[model samples]
Target: MKSLTSIIPAPPGWYARWRFGTHRTVTYPITTWALARDTGSEHTIVVGVDTNGMWPGGDDERPGGEFLRYIYEPIEAGTPDDVFNPVKSPADLASVG
Candidate 1:
């Protein structure tokens, strides 16, 4: 897997994407998750995981498993939570979309 914005390498059963946001005149693409919102984090961290249908580990609109996104640091991601926590500013949310 790879980060959506930075194309950084990710481990198997793991993936990374950015929150729908904006900063300093740059706008980040909108997504569905409670990932990092800062510009630096938006570019590097913000990750999640997934698996085949039988293992129950996917999170897109797809059926079976769910790939849970996160609100964690780039260096640490030992826990897993799937609560959709909104972290972007109202303006950022409105503007990015």
Candidate 2:
């Protein structure tokens, strides 16, 4: 899971997957929104997501899983002024950790 800032929505467009034989192709890019954190008390779906987690490819190319980032609004902030803070980016995540 990449950092929230690193989590970017897919560009608005049609992405068609090839069909097999007479099967219909799925060409719509579904947009999804969510959040990830180092810790959380509640989650809408699953939990314990390691943003730094990775998945090895069959050819051993990119091992950082199918996703490169995770997007989400913070539940509670680090401080009172943090509520208005801009979202963080991958470079920002690199600086923090």
The candidate that achieves the highest lDDT relative to the unseen native structure: 1
For all predicted structures, in order, the TM-scores are 0.19, 0.20
Kindly list the per-residue Cα lDDT of model 1 for residues 15-92, writing each as its tens digit.
Answer: 333333232112112233223233445344443332211111223433322322323333364323322225757675
Point out where model 1 deviates above 4 Å.
Answer: 1-3, 11-45, 49-60, 68-97
Residue 17 alpha-carbon offset, candidate 2, angstroms: 1.7
Give the per-residue lDDT digits (tens) of candidate 2, residues 10-31.
3333121222234222122224
TM-score of 2: 0.20
Error of 2 at 47 (Å): 22
RMSD of each: 14.8, 18.4
Error of 2 at 59 (Å): 17
